[model samples]
Target: MASITPWRQLLLDSIQANKHLRHSEYFQLATVKENGRPANRTVVFRGFIQGTEKLQFTTDARSQKIEEIKTQAFGEICWYFTDSREQFRIGGFLNVIGNAETNPLRLKIREQAWFQSSLDSRLQFAGPSPGIPCVKNGPDDNTTPKLDPAEGPVENFCLVTLEPQEVDYLNLRKMKRYSFVKTGDFSWTQRELIP
Candidate 1:
């Protein structure tokens, strides 16, 4: 089993302390577009990959972020826990696991995410291409098709993983802050920072 880093432990603690708030499960992901512009969006945090430090999230394959990620795989996630007045900026590289994935483990991970998603969540992947104009009653109709929760992911559904390289954690209430950078496979160097 891969050992958990100190920052990961802190993040887990923060998640437990603020589990009651729905927003605590959300974080802002920033990526650089092909045109050299930055794009940001809110993404729900899926649980970490088993026996790994990678963080997981789901996204539509047709979303603009996919192209952005292709242009630049490096990105950062900024997560804030309101109840705890804590924030974490995690910088890392992202991996998109889609229908074309051939690795057995990655395919299994994608399948697990699909099965774990709610029916309504899975239905979104069946809808029209995302980021396109929505029509009242045309092909863009927002009606969701029935999807079996146990079924595997659709073509448009992708499991994205973030491999953290650096983390900056801040606690507002205590006026304390720390920065951590990955030093080895399971080791990190932490430094105190002025909040």
Candidate 2:
């Protein structure tokens, strides 16, 4: 039997590891600010695109991150599974799937994603827009006036995709780490690192 290359193995591991951790799918996303600083925030890891290193997530169009992304598309995602002591740092560029007029496919994807969202999730957007002050005695508070998921693909809905150029995986359990960088079409370069 032949062994798979290091890069392929890393891809396989990432795809699998992310699948079973649905309930705990939060990762820290780091982006560069215009003032030459870094911004880090917690974002849910939606899913991965098969045959590619594209990661998916949803964000509000009014979110400050959207402006940051528009200004600088490059960002990084850090996933640390606390229980397993496994971590992955993914570096990539952002792809904002905006309104239907801009990207029809992204709109459809947003629709589908919305279709799958829970009432609780939909209610989040129904409240205050991202990064806005709470509406005094209004719907600004979370968990009020639940909205149907079917009603969305709201004006604020936006799909954000991460096109990963490199992935660094560290398995502290075994005390090993490596990085895989995409070099070309279906090609990657893997380098072991001292952890």
Candidate 3:
């Protein structure tokens, strides 16, 4: 049996214990042009694949992010655990979950959660018809709509799979400040830093 390093074990523990990190927002940075100029935006993480060690996210087929992914398969995702004062950064190639005909299982879970919450509000936003604007910046600023979780568009969503080849873990502590860079499949190198 192979022995796992302490840092590797800690990293896995943090992900497993939290299941999802709050401060760490998932974003995909992809190259748009040949010059390598990239575009990035925040994305919701669905879950992580245990066996393959890949992270999952959802997006719309019409979204620019999807186009970026198509043009450039490489990207990076960052997650900062505020409560734990730690940051996790992963870099890898992205693969779109094809089969547009079939609804994604991840989206199904998200849809069920949204449906159970506020049927009316969600239906209004996600319905075939357009929804009313919820936000008002000024007397005439009716364009900005307030976010209604219930009114999310389910059909417009699609899943993105990110299989990380490298991950960097940074722990922000006055003492015992540590950073671990995991390269390749399952190997990692730890470095101690001055806090």
Candidate 4:
């Protein structure tokens, strides 16, 4: 089994400490656009992959972020925990497990992510294509209808996994910070940073 990094432990602790807040699970994901500009949006953290440090998230394939990720596989996630007064900026590579994914493990994870999502969340994948101009009284203008859970993941539903390479952790209350860089498969080198 692979060892867990200290930064991962810190992040998990922060999550636990701030679990009461609904937004604690949300993070800002930033990706490089085709024109060299940065694109960012709030995404919910699904959880870490079992036995791995990778972070999991769900996305619609029709979202522009998918194209941005395909163009530049790297992304950075900025997560802030309110109650804990801490933040973590995680830099990593994004892996998309789409409808065409063939890896059994990845496919299983993707399906599980879909099934675990709320019905409203699952229906979003079946709605109109994201990022397109909304038409009056169109699908984009209203909440998506409920979907059957047993139908499984829609074609547009994707499981996004981020394999963290570097992480910057900051504790506002303590006025301290640290930078961690991956040194091996399951190890990292941590350095204290001036807050």
lDDT of 1 by residue, 73-143 (tens): 99999998999999999999999999999999899999999888888888889877878876777763656
TM-score to true structure, per model: 0.96, 0.82, 0.57, 0.94
Question: What is residue 22's positional error in candidate 1, in angstroms?
Answer: 1.5
Q: What lDDT score is found at residue 138 in candidate 2?
A: 63
User: Per-residue lDDT for 1-195 in model 4, tens only?
Assistant: 567678988998898999989999999999999999999999999998888888999999989899899899999999989888999999999999999999898899999999889988998888888778779986557675567778989899999999999999999999999999988776789999999
RMSD of each: 1.3, 3.9, 6.9, 1.9
Q: Which clashing pairs does model 3 show?
A: 24-80, 122-150, 122-151, 134-146, 135-145, 135-146
lDDT of 4: 0.92
Candidate 1, 182: how far from true, in Å?
A: 0.8
Q: What is the lDDT of residue 138 in candidate 3?
A: 52
| Regions of model 4 farther than 4 Å from truth | 137-146
In model 2, the number of clashes is 0
lDDT of 2: 0.75
Q: Roughly what TM-score does model 2 have, to 2 decimal places? A: 0.82
What's the lDDT for all of these models?
0.92, 0.75, 0.58, 0.92
User: Of the pair 2 and 3, which is ahead by lDDT?
Assistant: 2
Worst 10 residues of 2 by lDDT: 1-10
